[model samples]
Target chain A: MSGPATHVRGKKTLARSILGFVDKGLVNAVLVIVAIFWLVPTLGLFLSSLRTVGDSASSGWWTVFTTPAQLTIENYASLLSNPTITGSFWNTILIAVPTTVFVVIFGALAGYAFAWLKFPGRDWLLIVVIVLLAVPLQVALIPLARMFGTLGIFGSIFGVILFHVAFGLPFAIFLLRNFFTQIPAELLEAARIDGASDWRIFVQVILPLGGPAIASLAIFQFLWTWNDMLVALIFTNSGSQPLTVAIQSQLRQFGSNIDVLSAGAFLSMIVPLIVFFAFQRFFVQALLAGSQK
Target chain B: MTQLVAPVANSPAGGDKRRPPHGSSRRRMFMIALGFLAPALVFLGALVLYPIVYTVVRSFFSAGGGEFVGWDNYVTMFTNDSTFTAIRNNVLWVLVAPAACTILGLIFAVLLEKIKWATAFKLIIFMPMAISMLAAGVIFRGMFQENPNLGVVNAALVTVNSAFGQDAAYPGAAGRDGLGLVQDRGVIASESTVESGSEQNFPLVGIRVDSVPAAAAQAEPAVNARAGQLVGTVWLDVVRGGGGTSGQIDDGKTGLPGILVDAVAADGTIAASATTDAAGRYVIDGLAEGAYRVALPAANFDEGYQGVSWLSSTFITGVIILSYIWIWAGFSMVMISSGLSAIDRSLQEAARMDGANEWNVFTRITAPLLSPVLIVVFVTLIINVLKIFDLVYVIPPGSAKPAANVIAVEMWTVSFGGGNNQGLGSALAILLLILVLPSMIINIRRFREERQQ
Candidate 1:
């Protein structure tokens, strides 16, 4: 066990036991239990939404197994029929799409500069963006709310979109800049030596290469804007509130009306889930890259 | 002439035609970069940077934003109970939620190494990371309902308790007024001690007729007790349609079944005890020939497990933290798992070969090696929890909001949750920034260092 032969054996055994900090059986059991624990709440929400108000109020959701036929789509039907919720769904799309578009456009443009271009104060400017990433949105809420009101756009979807774009730029720029830097500098310089102007080089060179980062950033911004309640709550009027704010109103009013609340919650959740699952590889990759740094 | 002409073409200002002078070209590059960056910079300056500076300045102003009041809002914020509660709860969130998530994540990351269905399990755990805090709040709020019938948590607790432990037979049951039995501290005891060979009757009232067990039979009067024995009957004295004697069992009166009856001697020890039958009759067959009090212990009428009032002021903070951990633990796990995969496994193997057990290897080698990843996750979580608002706002009932308050939610409340005091709100916002700045700086430094490396 003291020589090169043992060292090789150690590597093989270590590969097997790298995860074996405890008994394998105990580890498996705990993992399964935790997985179940993580799953139960979301499962409850889905099952509870399908249950009638009376059925839901009388027994826990797991009891639905005893009488599975009682599950119905009425909650969802009613949720869709409600004018406020339906309108808010449209408002969410309205807010999210434009915000995503704007963040991507601006994030890509600035990210290109920070990545390939030489300028005075560039490093310091990048540092400012990093610091801005740390500032919580709370600091801006009061002043911006007042500013939006003075601009006569308060309580409108446009104002909410504007606010999101503003707050989202730091992170967008940060992520895009980092990702753009990874594009080989020689490629951009070669394009430049061929007489392509900076703008043409950005459009023809940087944007194509930065596609995955831009998509990831777009998905992140869209989901964030779609799921946002705080910004919409302050900036949008009732008429223009997104699904989050709209559902929040339902939560406050209905309290434990799981029938209505669960339907609304699942509705708000499903889009992000779809987007997330569709691009989860990129999403997780971006998260790992962004956070690890 | 060609040489002179060529010299002039390439000399001084002529170079500006083919390629700009160095200083001017540098300035031109700067202009182009500025043009590209201006939109984002403008938005950041106005929305992010300017608000930060404005908030700091506005903290000194009045609620109406008119009169200058130096340190008044800050003073009030520090002294106010709700603000203090918010600050204290923030400290708790900062302390507990991040560490819990990070630890749980590390566990999950390590555990996933040997598991067969690791990808599926990882997906299930990480699913919540995609969810909004608002939806997560709704999920948790429903999961922690106080009623066992509704709340899954309480239902499981109640089921486990009933299977292995005693639950109160009649929670919230009480005795009739002016009856021979007295209700004291949830116990219904005979007002007078009954000697052996005598009967004691407990005719309880106040239980709704519908709540009476369906299996309970009509009340039957207790039979005469033999010498050295005690007998008793416990029945629901109230009858439907309001036609029953106040302290006596009447027609259609149902028995309170499964209630424990205790006979305590003068020394306060239980001489004998029996459970009431379907007819509410209990016979303690071999009691000592001494006087004993026929009483129902508090357990008989105990309110049993109503589950936890998770939204109550006492537990709301914990509930919110639990939800935060639920949503965030996966993030930590994913990060730590990446780190785990990137580490050298032979070091752990060597340690194990040197007689270090699994736990020792994990603690000494694995954990110490993973510290960089762990610190990143921990600091990121610390920063995340400091500004947590959605679950705290949406999960707690309005009654428990003060207990669940953190600086972010407090700032919102003071400004727009009907307080209409943006000045104090700005003060709170600044305070939050102050609390969060150190973590931010650490993260930025780490980011810079990572970039350099």
Candidate 2:
């Protein structure tokens, strides 16, 4: 009886292992297919950009695999040499950098206040920030556009950056506050006992410990400001338009210039892709902080 | 737990009202908090709060803000056809795009659990999220072009059709005026009947020179009609670069190759059919001796599956929504995958131990546990889609812009997109705010719940 039971157990284990293997195989297949589906369109765009305009227009992008000699970098050369594309690329940096810097600074300060500082209506103020997170930026565009006109900042890069900073603070503060509140009370108390003021403790203790959160906030704010379009569209005119608006303007109704668009698109995508991959972990951490208890 | 510790640390000086130091400490903390919050508050007030208030006020006034119209703009928003179309399209987007992204995201997240190279997969999928909507718009617009030579999608479609031995039709061909053919919609048909042994001449015009197939031969009128057979010539009547007689197949005219011609009996049945060759000549042999209408069927002028007119009014919204889904599905995947990782594995393992299948375990144990994250992601997408402007503004062609308009784009158009009517735009803005408020409330509540947990 014991021998038969052992044999049966071995058989069961073998079947289960086979099932597990099949499960893994199935999962990998789906993942691979989905990954390919997501990557192919961008790959097609990139490949088409690498080919001459006539070659790209005459054949499907997949044909490039068979005919490698058709590939050329002329599109990229022309796009980079063009003054408007390069100028807008710099304009994007100008807008993104200032917006990111100010958002992080202001967000950190406000986050520190909400987390550690004891003040009248602190909870109410924090709630306000949380609620503001839901306020679509569209609601503010008209009034703000008009106000920018009055302040002589409409259609300027400064106006665009200021709008991004204002809109970015809510989520930035929310994330930082969550990070800051998790700090042990004993750390802040010890700093106070050492005669450090609130400002000193924030700068010395909280700021240093909140590296992940700050990194997360900076990455998020940077990506948002860099990829932003609607605000820039309504606020910035031709002189101050970012790469997004510039790319948009190149889109013609009939017989669109695919060569320029493909190259410009690839160029615009490169910086954010770098930022994303470099700080991917921080982005995931930010996602967890925002969603997790 | 931290909340419980916070007040105790602040009250270390004791609760005695008589202590001057304690009162001073509380006041000092308040002042410090205010100082820390000052810059963010100023910007938030000036940009977010004040603008919100001013938009509400502006919505009540006339276009130029000179008169107090008092809900007149709101009335126009509901009354105007374009604005109404915008509202309807926004509702469609809200109903479709977010749900699709979330579901796709959830599936990708769940499937990622079984793979070794999950990180790479996630990165590729999430790569689109990094691209600007403007770039995405451009990519999708180019991809969905109607011409096979210009658009990747149509090119693939044409390849597949040809591979399956299906001949493509000439969508651009039409009958020349006074060619004795009746034109209905786009299909052209011979009005008079022809005898079986008689020759027919189908002289068509309006086929663009570049659109002509490269294999097409020079047009020649058919001659030497055989008995009990019908012969015809379908050629481009217009001659390039010079004057040509109308409704006549003159020299230098190109053949309308590959057009399907049919001989229809009086009972509306096709008696015989033939396809034109390179020289625009076709012959239907063995036809019964009867008068038949030489017809060009609708398929001949069908525009021949130009791959969906993605930028056309009928499909512009769908294309925009598709682009939105592409960018956001990766975002949803990453968010939900993180949530999936946080889920307690023991619950799933226990369900499996009970002899449950993978689907059962997932639906019963895993999905239930992941609901909070799913709801958070879904609501976030809802708010995001409500404010979607760039894709709508950038993706659709000028002709389809009105058809694909979302509230955000409508707001811009009414005020800035050459409408220059700020009052109505402000009303549209407020309507958008009201539309987004419910999801925003749900998201905040979800955040509060997550914090509590």
Candidate 3:
């Protein structure tokens, strides 16, 4: 009876392994198809951007695979030479960099205080942070636009960056606070016993320990600010419009300027891709941590 | 603030041996914490909290902020056709877009587990989450262009359509003016009736010579009809070099084949029907002896199978939702994938050992385990979708914008997109906030529960 049972178990294991192998292959096949479906839009845009105006208008982007010589950088060259695209590109950097830096600095300080400091209403304040995280920018636009107009900074790059940093704080503080709370309290307590001030402890201990979270927060904020069109559109005029708004202006009602649209869009899309890939490890780590919130 | 600080200032003589004056130190800690938190608090309070309160208050005021007009703005928003359309579209967006993203995310996450190139697949899928919604709008706008030659989507549709043998014969062909054939409601018919055993001719001119089907042969005149039969020819009337006579099936013309011809009797009933052949000629044999009008129905000249009018007002909302799903599904996928990785593998192994198939394990075990993560993603998506503006704003054409309007875009348009009605826009914004509030509460509750755990 024991020998027969063993034989049956061996056959079951072999069959299960075979099933698993088949399942893996099937799943891989579906994944490949899905990946292709997912990549085709961006891929088409990339290929379209590299083609000449006539080629883009005359045929679909995929035809270039058969006739590779149709590919050219003329569109991109013309796009770069256009003052509007280049200026907006510069304006995006101008907006994203300051927003990122300010959010990280203020968020780290506030997040540390929320995590470690003994203060009244701290939990309530953290709850407010969570609530603020859920507050959509639409809620703030009307008043802020008025306020900025009153302050004489409406439609300025400075005004846009201020709003970006302001809105970025909630998630920044929330994510960093959660990460900082997980750090061992004893390390900070030890630093305090040795006469380290709260600022020193935060800079020396919490920042180093919360590096991945802070890095991810910065990336998230930068991307959010960079990709932001609603806020930019509402706030900035044509002169101060970021690449998104600038490119969007060229979108005709009935006809397409495919050459200009594709190149400008690709240029806007490439920066965040680079930033995201470069810090993908931290990005993923932050995603997992932030998901729990 | 001074009440708390006064104790520290007055307690210089109250130092204890071990704690170094607890009240003063605690006060210092509070002050330090306050100092640390002040900057973020100021921004949050000024930009987010204050603006929310101000928006609510301003919603009750007049457009120029001069008068307290009570709920007039809210009533106007509810009554206004555009704003009402915006609200309805927002509901549709919240219903469709998030659910699509969540479902697609689940499938992608689950499938990624069994694939060897999971990381690469994930990267490809998640790549869109990095690009701006404006850029995505441009991509999808380009993708869904009406012209098949330019848009990849329409081009693909045209390819599959032709591969399935569903090409239109002649989309825009028309009869020439002063010709014997008269067109009405896209159907062309002879001006006068012909008795059976008589011949008819249809001279079409609108279709470009080159645009005619490749299989079309040179124009042919109808053969003389036999007894009790009607014969006819339908061919491109214009000659290639533009010297052909009106109503004549001239040289260099080709047949418009596969066109349906009807022989309608005087009683408004069809006595016989025939389809044109490759040489544009048709024979209706065994017809009754009464006079019949040879007619071509509307189907042959239709703007046939012009790929889907995706950006039309009717389909604009759906197209915007699709683009939203395209950009956001990867976000949910990455989130759910993280949750899946955290799930214990032993339960799935146990289910497999018990002879449960992959589907059963997935449905009965894996999905149940991932419910928490799924709820988070779903609620997050709900909140996100409620505020969707960019894709909604940018993808649709000017004509279709009203159909695709969401609350966010409506608010923008009302305030900034030339409406200049800040009061109405504020009310719309407040409406959006109210819509998003429930999900935010659910999310906050979940966070509180997680914190307690």
Candidate 4:
């Protein structure tokens, strides 16, 4: 009986090892392939941006590796030299930053109220906000544009910012409300017993505790406003147009200027990539929180 | 300590002894809550609620919002061919793009589980999510360009084709008008019959100078034709500049190489066919001594692999949809991956221990558990794709824009993109709102379910 048991154990170990090896091999193979598939298009764009216009037009981007001397920063330089492109870059910053700051502040305040503070009609109001989450931005564009026009803020960065802030509130309020609800009610009560006013408790306790949620909200709002084209397209005139609108206009129909396109596209992509990587963990956590209640 | 004291502090006797009475305190708290909620509510009312109401109202008016039209714009929208096309394309988008993204994301997420570098893989895949839709549109537009030298996708396709010994014939080639060949549909055929042993000359035009192959030699008239053979020359009639005669092969003209020329019998059947060489010369040998029409088959004049015509009316929506998938698939993957990670590994193991195979374990355990997340992702994507505007607006060229329009884009076009019909645009906006509401309800319900769980 001992001899048969020993033989069985040896056979089981061999099978387990083989299984582990195959699993690892299959996982790695799939990971690598998917990674390549995701990376190649961006890789093509990046490599094309690095090459001169003539070189890019004459040969494939893959050929840049074979002829190392063909790479150039001329496209980037030329794009930077253009006044409109540079102006639109600043315009994007002007719109995104203010929108992010305002949305976070208002969203957090509203979220705190809905979570802890009790008021008449609070539940109904919260429900209203929740339903507003589904309102397609398209439904608002024409009416809002007309309103902005009447208000004389149309074709301005402020108009765009206002539109963004308004549209951004529902999601921000929803996310932060859910996040704020998880805070222990006891903590706020204790603060209340310590003679802190409601505002004091909110400012002193809730704000600090809500860092992750706020960061997530800020990142999301910033990215949306910065990368936005439709809002900026309708609201901002020629002077206040964001980088997205600028890049889009540069796309000529008859013959595309590839040099401007590749460089401008890279320029537009870089800032969001920076923000995404910088706060990637927070973003992921927010996504989980947002999706999983 | 705090827990024991907390209840006592919150007890009515203790709290009443230290604080204001319930009525005034409630009023003050309500005011404070009002203060906090006012800004968001005001913004929501002024921006969202008011606009929505106004859109519904204005939709009934005329283009300038001056006259009440009473559903006329809605009638116009539903009846308009372009608007119908937009609706059809949008339906296609909602059906295909989201499903493709969700499935790809699911595959990626599930496969990511056993990998050591899962974080890195997820980041790379999610990278496109950071790119603005405009940039993505640009990238895809360039990537799908018809010109091989310009578009990366076609460049790769051309390389693969050439590697496999298949090559494209001249795209955009045509028969010169008033020449011996008559152009019909896409085919260029002989206007008159030629007897065997006669040399027929076919002059082609409209091939771009740069598109002409480097191996193309100067046009040469067909050499002496044998008694049993038919011969022809297919050469570019136009010169680089503007000085060439219309129907004659002029000096400095180049041969339209690789053109397929055929000899047709009286019954329209192709009796013989020959492909042109570098000198634009083809000789159909072993033809019977009879009258035959020297013709260029439609395949010769048919547009060669111009790499998909991505910006054309036929494929513009597809190109835009591709771009959307590229940007959002990463987002779906990350969302679903987090859900996937929260799944119970013990359940999977238990199924495995019960002698379930990998596929069964996945199908029975993993998929059912992940269905909620999948539904949420799908619903969110549907909501998103329904209103997709930027890629559709930015990717297609001017000629194809009408074909690739979505409801959101058509709304903009009518209101702003030169249509200037505010009533129609408002009606379109309301229609979009109605369409998106169902998906939004589903998504909200899913969110509530997830929260309950």
The per-prediction CA RMSD against the true structure, in angstroms, equals: 5.8, 6.4, 5.7, 6.5
Candidate with the larger DockQ of 1 and 2: 1
Q: Provide the clashing-pair count of each candidate structure.
A: 1, 0, 0, 0
Flag regions of model 3 displaced more than 4 Å: A1-26, A51-70, A189-195, A252-256, B1-21, B162-168, B174-182, B189-203, B218-225, B232-234, B237-253, B288-291
**RMSD of candidate 4 to true structure, Å:** 6.5
lDDT of 3 by residue, A58-141 (tens): 788999989999989999889999999999999999999999999999999998888777677877898899888878898899
Q: How close to the true structure is residue B301 of candidate 3, measured as C-alpha lDDT?
A: 78
Write down the TM-score of every candidate.
Answer: 0.88, 0.83, 0.89, 0.81
DockQ, every prediction:
0.47, 0.42, 0.46, 0.43
Model 1: lDDT of residue A268: 92
DockQ of the two-chain complex in candidate 4: 0.43
Interface RMSD, Å, model 1: 8.0
* TM-score of decoy 1: 0.88
| lDDT for each residue of candidate 1 in B1-453, tens digit (9 for 90 to 100) | 001111112132110222232676767777888999999988988878888889999999999999999999999998999988899999988989999999999989988987879888778888888888999999998888788888888888888887777643676678777777787899899888889999998888767555567879999988888998888789988776778777777898888888899998989899989998899999987887889999999988776766678778999899889999899998898889999999998898787667676679889999999999999899888878888989988998778888889989998999999999999999999998898789888877987887667
**lDDT, candidate 1, at B108:** 92
Instruction: Indicate the worst ten consecutive residues by lDDT in candidate 3 chain B.
Output: B9-18
lDDT string, candidate 2, B158-254, tens digits: 7787677545466667777776888787767888899999988888877667667799988888877788889989888878887788766778888
> What tens digits encode model 4's per-residue C-alpha lDDT throughout B1-453?
011223333332111222332676767767888999999989999999999999999999999988998989999998999888888888999999999999989988888776778889889988888779888887787778787877877877767766775353566777777766777777787888999998888888777677677989988888899898998788888777678777666788888788788899989898998988888889999888789998787776554454557678888887788788778888889988988888977787767656566689778999999998898788778878888998988788878888888888888889998999999999998988898888767766765665456
